[model samples]
Target chain A: MISEDYDRIDATLRSTLRDVLGLSETRAAALDADTPLFGAMPELDSMAVAGLLTEIEERLGILIEDDEIDGEMLESYGALVRFVATKTRR
Target chain B: MLRFGPDQGPLVAVALPLFEDANRVRGFAVAICRALAARGVATVLPDLPGQGESLVPLENCGILDIADGFDCATKEAWNANRRLYGVALRSGALLDKLALLDGRWHFAPQDGPSVLRDLKRIKQASQPHIRLSDADWYFDLQAPADHPDPPVEIAGNLISTALLTDLSVYAPWTPADGGPVRIVRLDSDPAPADRHVPGTALWRRAEPGNDVTLARLLADDIADWIATCER
Candidate 1:
């Protein structure tokens, strides 16, 4: 099981996705650690990536470099959550 | 569509349109002009090169050419006694990052990489992107501009390699050292401007999305903000 902190992060991530990607709350809640992004989610297009990063930066209070982003980090929900976790820890 | 009030008031030159129709909020740029006119604010809506009624060919246009249009739009405001304010929507907000710096409102400005990447994805082309300079970028191309076939269309916009090279590496947002930027982050901020009621994505392309009430509220909010800032 994930820690309570991760649960909160996941919750926050869900809300960010909803706001940036325009996903519904019900659709957002269904997403889990293994949920694939980019290809799987039609709404998370190239333009949405910019919007997503902006929202993530504001919501998590972390700064992400353009070079730091890769397909792997956005490959799955867990990958994104871990990325945020690592950034927050730093 | 350049709009001015009866009395000579502060002018808002909208630059760097987020999408095709600049200043289009629920088909309300004209409505916004009227609204701002009532509030004593003159507004100028300058069309990008190769856009709207402009006769410039789409393939001949570049980002610098677009910025030129922005410059001409704000010239009248610059000469005036009162300070000229700029309003850049979405990625167009990058205009504030450039030479055009007046009191401004940036409604969710987008970065350059995001724009380039989005351009690539819309065409479903997975070519590599290379950044040449701060405001230049390169995308891998299959052929030169004078290729056999005509210019290809991507995302409802005709584009060529020359255009792509010019639009490649624009990173507008920097660390705000108390600069002249006021971004109303619609996604993060709890302000009324960012409110997202269900089935109400006004910026959605597939659906006919128009929220008249919210548009009015947002226009009012923008007017109030500009009025306060100009004061």
Candidate 2:
């Protein structure tokens, strides 16, 4: 049940990434679970990252701290999905 | 007595932002207040003590002291039809701690100084300056014969380390309400000029040009906040 819930959340996240970051379908799909978002996309600089985090929090009802984020955590879409799941659990 | 229309304007209180600079609302504060006012609520946008046209010098005030002054201002103005919703743009979000001042809120954190710096870094990798017109001046990385990679940097003791610290502490995603505070966040990517605050009925507007469009958008947002808070 939880995995199914995770999948739903994951799909929403992908859509959000596309909508908020203005990513094309192909570009967004090219992302895997552990891809590095910060350096990978020039658009994902600090401001975008901050905006992304805000979008995620509003969508998933999670709170994130600047210190809580790191390269590995935001590496990919799958990674972000897992991160959201973890945060939601808490 | 006069009857107002369904699209009647909101009740708004306007004042200068909290900063050493005399003009400009903080950032996200503009959005929050505008959203509220758009809903026919009542809101007030006050300038911090020692800033704006208030006659006090920026050097004479500290963060906490500024917060205190704002609090006092809100309380003195509170009335039956008025709800003090403090709006803080960018680093101004820290002033929400002074919400106890008005006990009413509609906070938003727009692309503040650090975020602006980060954008400039990504844009031209250079610092920014205030032009004679108070417009944020930037170096054109594309001007050629310049350094590698586009970079725009904004420098000055005006944006103090203390100000940076205050801004960094705010997490726009989570309102002190433990939910998404009514907000509209602007993204630098693809440069969408407008945004919508999710979960809440509020709107988030984004636009390029730190001059007219930015200021106008903020003013619209503040107007909305005042409209909503009035209820």
Candidate 3:
């Protein structure tokens, strides 16, 4: 079974990248929170970004409006998780 | 039809294949089957009529007919032993009867209307270089009897208008009447679920290629579920 840490936001985020972007566990974990995702990761192109957004909704059980996600929100893992946490709390 | 794992125990009935990009679906099925085999479970991945190396022409097939084909395959597997389970993915989930098996595992099941909408969108997106003389067949999701023949282009495959029309109206056949459904939606699955949600939709990764890592993960997930079900 894949190792899982459900409590940590970074753990969840990394796992999400592993599943969505098909990254290895090491590769996903290697990504720092400040690491840019949108423009940096070729896999995170426009379509992949849209998919990642929808997946964030499904995985977190939260609704994310289209207007809520901009390039800035996806700039880094920290930014994306912060946006998710805020939306989920709201 | 492809067989995987040890064929001794309950056979998994894989039904209602992806209408488009049959190869990608086939690849995932192979992975899932191997995973199941590792857990000592077997699966029968039937090539949907007229697709996936099937000799039948698309014009000769329809929605209900394909569902019936699934039934035949499922029953065949069950007949081998009195036990049966099911795994349906994406548009394949339209075959609700897969739920009737001893255990049910579903991934990203879409409703008929939504699938039709996506097809229409793809057709529209592939504009300017429209292939058909009477392109309404693409827009309306129907193949008029008079509007030419089989082998129309869709999602990188040549399909029949009759089959496409049948798919356009394909109804949502939920497994509500059967066992508890384990749902994992990576794509636009209209169905609800019970825990174990994946954080990504890798079914059709937009890199214009298949996602092997996610595919393996899903196979492991399904195999784990099958092992649990057997226990």
When superposed on Cα atoms, how far off is each prediction in RMSD? 6.2, 11.9, 7.6
Q: lDDT (0-100) at residue B50 of candidate 1?
A: 60
Off by over 4 Å in 3: A1-90, B96-100, B129-152, B187-191, B206-231
Chain B: TM-scores of all predictions:
0.73, 0.46, 0.75
In candidate 1, what are the lDDT values of residues B14-67, reduced to their tens digit?
Answer: 664544424234254455556667666777767666666667776666666666
What Cα-based lDDT does every candidate model obtain? 0.61, 0.48, 0.63
**Per-residue accuracy of model 2 over A2-87 as CA lDDT, tens digit each:** 87887767766776677657678987777776666767777776545655666676556566654466667778777778778888
lDDT top scorer: 3
Estimate, for each residue in B1-231, the C-alpha lDDT of model 3 and write its tens digit.
888777576778786455553454666667667766766777888876666676765556766667666777677655566577778877787764533477767777665655554454455345524443333455334657676655556556555556667666775554565564677765323346654443334354543344456667777777777667778
State the local distance difference test value for candidate 1.
0.61
Q: Compose the digit string of candidate 2's lDDT tens values, residues B60-108.
A: 4555666666666656345443434454544455445554433222333
Provide the fnat value for model 1, as a fraction from 0 to 1. Answer: 0.05
Model 2 residue B204 distance off true place after TM-score fit, in angstroms: 9.7
iRMSD (Å), candidate 3? 5.7
Clash pairs, candidate 1, are B16-B92, B136-B169, B137-B168
How far out, in Å, is residue A75 in model 2?
Answer: 3.0
2 or 3, greater by lDDT: 3
Winner on lDDT (1 vs 2): 1
Q: By summed lDDT, which 10 consecutive residues of candidate 2 chain B come out lowest? A: B200-209
TM-score of every model? Answer: 0.64, 0.45, 0.61
Between the candidate structures 1 and 3, which one is better when assessed by DockQ? 1
